[model samples]
Target chain A: MTPPRTPVLGRRSLLAAGAALPLLARPAIAQNSLKGTKLTILAGSWYVPENNTQLDQLAAEVSKDTGMEVRVERFAGDELGTKVASVIGTGRGADLGVGVEFDTYLYAPKLLDVTDLAEEIGKQYGGWFDVARAACMVDGRWKSLCIGQAPAAWNYRTDMFAAAGVDKFPDTFDELLVAAKKLHAKGTPIGMTLGHASGDARSTNYPVLWAFGGKEFEADGKTVAINSPETIAATEWYAECFKYMDPGVTAWLDPDNNQAFLAGKCSATINVNTIYLAARAAAPTDPVKKNIVENMNHGLWPKGPAGRYANYNINVWLPFAASPNPEGQKAFLRAWYSKNFLPNWTKTGQSYFIPTFAGFDAMDVWPDDPKLKIFRELNKLNRLAGYAGPPSPAAAEAVSKYVLVDMFAKACTGQMKPAEAVKWAERQYDQIAKKRRA
Target chain B: MSATTLPAAPARPRARRLASWLDNERTLGLLLVAPVVILLAALVAYPFFTAIRSALSDQTLADAGEFVGLDNFANLFQDDIYLRALRNTLVYTAASVVAKLVLGLALALLLNETFPFRRLVRAAVLLPWIVPTVLGTMAWLWMFNPNFSVLNWVLTNIFGLRGLPWLTDPALAMVSVITVNVWRGTPFLGITVLAALQSIPPDLYDASAIDGANKLQRFRYVTLPLVMPVLLTALVLSTIWTFSDFGVVYGLTQGGPMNATHVLATLAFRTGLTAGQIGEGAAISLTMLPLLLVLIVWQLRRIRRSAVA
Candidate 1:
């Protein structure tokens, strides 16, 4: 006002004010964005305390970065699917849910489309595995994200095998059966699942079926192929194998086999690495741990008649369509994929969670434990329940019904003859196919 | 006489209107219960009707099913597993209920005696009932494990008996599930019967004793008759609960040993939630209704007869 306003001073004042305005407004904008941000994820208690710890760590890191509160609710794997479905049916649930055999694709319309994120991840990790693609892809789009593969292996007692005079894990199903019978005579019968277990029944039974060349459905997806002669042979062979297994194998779920192995009751069992992880996590002085560490050995599923095929327990993470915080979900996915988070999570799992992405194959978690070397083949020689067909709703229904597993179980349990059980399962496949057709 | 009635007391319009309103008891009753009626219809009736409709269709978790008319029901009858489930459910409910009644009555009789720490004993007896079913079932599951089973150890080592396959063999799996159901349910039956036992007039027992009735005779005659109403009520309630029990079996055996233990509830769960055959599951669940209605009718008749007697 005084001395003929300096042009430079005016210009400087205007520029400074313009810059300061945005700076002053930035806090308000951030405050508004962060006002009530929150997200909830229904995580499976897949690996127990370790899975819980990793989830907490992930949540903490996510909260720190995004300023969004994250709530992780852990449910047992057996109950998680029903809980997720119940909440979904009511149109109320956490922002995201993870399921192993829940077949998230069955409820694709209720899930948020993660095509862009999934594609980006696929590009980053090379292409996804065929099983992963089958599990997550629906209607030509990715409906969920493949989290990990719970690779199944024969967690057998080396001492038992040695005592039974078996030099190695059998290379063929017949050899394995002979070894199992020898073990059974020794009073430590091999424990195999012949029940309605989502994981064990599928993991143990599917391979036997696939090896014997029994497909749940034909490639057409409409024709039921489970009652074929190949399946009948598989059933008869499995029934014989059942004789060498613990009588209770028919009632055992996924955890039973692990417990049986740990308790020194079973010579061998087909299971995820939870058995190994539990033994490893035990106190150094724990006898169970010592026994397992010293006696336990891992092997690939024995070659079946057709060839060896392993039932892959593929778990997927699905974001709900009703989720209000897609931003938070996206952010969490980004955090989950980071090197800082995934390797640690995989390590915490103790090989129970095999990274689906090939990029993480070099993680020290796998190489550190010699036992885990077996898991490297999990994705390589794996098949899901509906191998010949896509994981269609009908296939999902059949798997959920434990159609193939029941066929084996019924035969083993003497509830039905091998042929009758195969026929029974074929009828189930027909019903599911009919529903899908309708 | 008509004239003497004071010309019928010229009625005010207000009084006439009030009388008319009050005299219409049907409308008044409906108006009074409208809220509750509407609430019940919204809550109970709606879902029930929806389930019935869904059962007749070809619905999955994804699609709104088209009406396929008795197709779902037709499919259910052909399903051997469903037939097995129906049989298993009946066996489970019958075995569990009978076992619970016998054991619960024994427990009530034992607890009725005067002794030191009797209150503590009663409370301790309630522990199984008070502990959540799923948690209790989990403990039993551990105890039934083929390797670490405490029960097996007790039998094999202590009793010098061979280890029994508690949940492995088809016959044994049914036994194991029934045993567990009895374990969790007996306490409820005991506590309720105990309450009923206490409420019975002590004078009646004294009278029965005076009439030269022995302990068994007193129980057979006086105690039973007096406790019959409560016992029947408990039995009916227990039957319904046991018939529909899902958690215990699901948690323990999951209807396994080749579908030996699957009840209607687990079958429905397997069908609808697991198999995504929502329509078939609903049909399976609704199958419980006809039988359940029969039970309710039976219960009501018994209750009315008892009330009259």
Candidate 2:
């Protein structure tokens, strides 16, 4: 009696409009809010050049969609950390950038909190991996968006393994030692960097440490537990293994193993998929590359006495707290995580950038290539640099200092006994902890 | 009116007075030097003071940090890596300077001789110094590559010897880095010493020869004394440069194979920038000041004493 009956067409129109609300409203709001604003991103130059081109395209697309000026600056991977640190300290620089490892924790206080954005992306992507959360979440807040991990596995030559009388890559460290000796005798020795290389050195050595039940810290993330018997055992094992490896492993920087493996100088080495991808890329032109492409396969990191583990370098997208246009930065991240952008970017990496989302594990990218299949499970066993401890600045400092790598290197090189090496690393950890406490 | 009138003294214009003032020696000298003083203040003094302040404090890359006085310095000694880096710096600098002086003096003496395309040879000698340190070091890096080293290839294939671990063994890495330092640095000393060698009067050599001095004696008596001052100067400069060298070690080895080659500069960079401990890094750098000061002071004293003699 009080109101006239609403028309069927009108109710239908209202329902449709309500359903279309977000689709219509989001872009308009984002466009207007960010109009005339600018977004600058600083990223480490990717090993795959196409990844950089794809990111640039993404920035261009985001700019066009939001009417914001967007720019991306690329630097060498090693230099990006220092640049980001400067940006955080000065409260100026790029609005958004890529941070390596647990840099989110290293600069957490000055990083923009993106909990809502992270949750939204996670919900859409079937949730982030535990490693991603461990890398980016600080104090229960998402401080950065984990882009993906560059899984470091043993990229081996199958023919060499066969020639050495090993049918497959070794499954355990003990077996790996025996295989290494045979491979050495066969003149195709295994190589893992024991140098100060930020990527390969830590990636290989940390797993060995963890596999032997040694950790840099107790679970409390504060105590120095590196001087334990497990560490000495790990060191001793590494020293014996060192006897059979290429003598140059200790001097290898991040790129040396890739060069050695590609040149057929080493039978097996711990590295990311870049070496395989590179070989495949060169196969058509170079017969040697073609041969390498055919003979090479990726293997899981050898299991240790404790357990199998990995320390893949995790890359994340961090927005600075000093960003003048926080909303615009968040919008760009949203667009970045969208299906249109992320899938293409992930594909461009050719599994080198294993997406941090668990949903990506089922994606066609991993299964399509047999060599990359090893990477699908790599994230599961992956641990942050400071195993059994929070990814704190102290741990990052220890990593930058190359403590664990040096500990193994010293024992391997006979600079110190395994026990002394363990003690040396323990003292380093103690000093780092003491400084952090102060 | 004509008889009583005296010419009124001309009043000088303000612009003319200013021009005269500017023309004065003291004012002109100061004006010429002002920009340089300002530049040094901005580029050097300010940063130097800031570094000192940082060294005194607990500054990190992320935190402004509070002053902890000498705690950072005290802790540096306790840190084995820092101690190792200190020792490396000494050994690296000493070895490099000594090698460079010998090689550079020999190169200068060779270049000073009458030879075909002498100018061309001198220019070619400068190629190492002219090439950027990073680029040249990268070439050396390849030469020292463990698997594909051309140096090793030559050693194994031609000499029928085992390939040495040029960059792998701790002792070898130190040697490799020092070799690079001497390689790059010798040219600088050579060029500098050659200029001094050319300036020495030919009559002095003739006079020494006429006095029955042999070629060796002539060099020992006449040439040595003449080039000694210049050689000392070159040695001082080379010592400073080698002591603070970051590029050669960083490029070739990056203080690796167990920190066998970490000089002060690379260690400071690793600690301060890479590790984000700005204060400790600054402290490490500041430790260089006293050593450098002693060196500079001794150099000046020697120069003064020689001049007086």
Candidate 2 clash pair list:
none
TM for chain B in all models? 0.88, 0.92
For model 1, how does the per-residue alpha-carbon lDDT over A333-374 read when each residue is reduced to its tens digit?
755655455566666565676777766665565636677678
Angstrom error at residue A259, model 2: 1.6
The superposed Cα distance between candidate 2 and the true structure at residue A237, in angstroms, equals 1.5
Q: For each candidate in the order shown, give its overall lDDT on alpha carbons.
A: 0.79, 0.86
TM-score of each model, paired residue for residue: 0.87, 0.93
Worst 10 residues of 2 chain A by lDDT: A1-10
